[model samples]
Target: MNHLEYVTCGTCSRLITIDVDAAGIIRNLSFLGGCSGNLKGICALAIGKPATEIKNTLKGITCGSKDTSCPDQLATALEQMGY
Candidate 1:
């Protein structure tokens, strides 16, 4: 598995750490310093999903007019991982 930890930029969350396989399927995911329930839900949705799929689904999401959100930051992090 490939592992990466990312510090989110311009989002509510401060950090995201993840593990994925060669196929880009998520093995684990976690967030720090965000809306607890929502972040947990995001983690649930993300685990076992392809990083590319998650990135595509979440890349443009925004929070309350902010240009980026936790989800969007995840997408960016996935991209940084070369998804």
Candidate 2:
């Protein structure tokens, strides 16, 4: 397993951390300084899912009129990490 942590930009959240296996399946996930309940739910749903799948599912999400969202940031982060 490998651990990845990312500092988000242009969003209410400050951080996103995840644990992924060799095949890019998420083992764990966490976020700091965001909508608490929603983030926790995102983390829970993301666990054990493939990073690529998550990224594709979340990549274009927007928070109101903002160009990006917490979920979008996660996708960007995972892409940067080569997931």
User: Highest TM-score among the candidates is held by which one?
Assistant: 1
Could you give candidate 1's per-residue lDDT for residues 5-82 as a string of tens digits?
999988878999999999889999999999999999999999999999999999999999799999999999999999
lDDT string for model 2 (1-83, tens) is: 87878999999999999888899998888999989998999988889899999999999899988999999999998888787
Off by over 4 Å in 2: none
Q: Tell me model 2's lDDT, rounded to 2 decimals.
A: 0.90
lDDT of 2 at 9: 91
Model 1 — which ten-residue stretch has the worst lDDT? 4-13
Every candidate's lDDT: 0.94, 0.90
RMSD of 2: 0.9
> Which stretches in model 1 have alpha-carbon errors above 4 Å?
none
After the best TM-score superposition of candidate 1, give how far the Cα of residue 23 lies from its true spot, in angstroms.
1.7
C-alpha lDDT (0 to 100) for residue 29 of candidate 2: 88
How many clashes in each structure?
Answer: 0, 0
